[model samples]
Target: MTRQLVAATKALLVLTLVCGVGYPGAVLLVAQLVPGRAAGQPVLVDGREVGSHLLGQPAGGPGWFQGRPSASDASGELSGGSNLGPSNPDLAAVVADRAASLRAANPDAAAAIPPDALTASASGLDPDISPAYALWQVPRIAKVRGLDESAVRRIVAAHVEDAPLGMLGQPRVNVLALNVALDARTAGEE
Candidate 1:
């Protein structure tokens, strides 16, 4: 019994060290070494860091690009999804309100509202949105920034990232990155 207990204890310690410490350390090392993906791809603006590329944030001003809806608190540590089904009345009301706000903000835009602009993502922390969603806000953003619509559209186009591996997913625009670029451009114009 004593020998058996010793053997079990040794095995448990070895397994714990291997899985908990060694595996995580190895992964971190590899991630840091990867090109264009190190340090979790933090977003920067004008030589200063603003936010991470993995989290969503609120861009309340019309001059900035908006990110996906977030169920997290303002600090963004406690993240969650609303989890309301499509038929849920509360969800429907929220969507309607968002749509109305978008329409009011872009009264002159001829394009139909995109779903991503109105609906919350599943994680509620998605950093990217569909390119269509960004385009939908171009008119409002351009007006607020006092920039030409074509210029805002060009900025959006420049920031649009293709789907991973060319076909693995839909094209997306990283909202935080785009908004940073917008602010930089505005600063340049000043």
Candidate 2:
């Protein structure tokens, strides 16, 4: 009994140190090796930090291409979905409302409104939207920005990031990056 107890105690301490202390230290060291990512990939504009690429922002205005409907008010702090299942009346109502808004905003957009535009992502901090969603908003964004529709569409296309390694996820557009690029273009025109 004594021998078994001693062995168990030794194993616990050894495993705890290795798994808890050592593993975390190694991870921190590796993370430190990458500079911008280690520091949370801050998205900067005009040398001033606007937001992080990993998070979402409340991009409303006509000139901006909006991301998915964020349950967390587009801030990453309280990231989560609405928790309403598909059949929930409330969820349906919200989706309907959102679809109506999108239609009203982009009357020229003939494509069916993308699901990403009507529903919130599981992580309310989704900074990206489907390419279709981005394109759907191009007409409105161009009209608001006073730029040609094709030019704005090209901007959206340029910012469309492919799936990681060509297979993980669908191609999407980062709303923050796209808006930043739009701002830069507008500034250039000024």
Cα RMSD to native, each candidate? 2.0, 2.6
* Stretches of model 1 off by over 4 angstroms after superposition: 73-75
lDDT of 2 by residue, 20-92 (tens): 9999999899999997898889998879999888888888588898888988896667889999999899999
lDDT of 2 at 151: 87
Which numbered prediction scores highest in lDDT against the true structure?
Answer: 2
Question: Model 2 reaches what TM-score against the true structure?
Answer: 0.87
State each candidate's clash count.
0, 0
Question: What shift in Å separates residue 19 of candidate 2 from its native position after superposition?
Answer: 6.3
lDDT of the candidates, in the order given: 0.83, 0.90
Q: Tell me model 2's lDDT, rounded to 2 decimals.
A: 0.90
Tens digit per residue, CA lDDT, model 1, 1-190: 9999999999999999999999999988888777457675777766887888877878767678877656563245766778888889999998888888888878977898888888777677788999998988888898888999898889899999999999988999999888888888888889
What TM-score against the true fold does each predicted structure earn? 0.89, 0.87
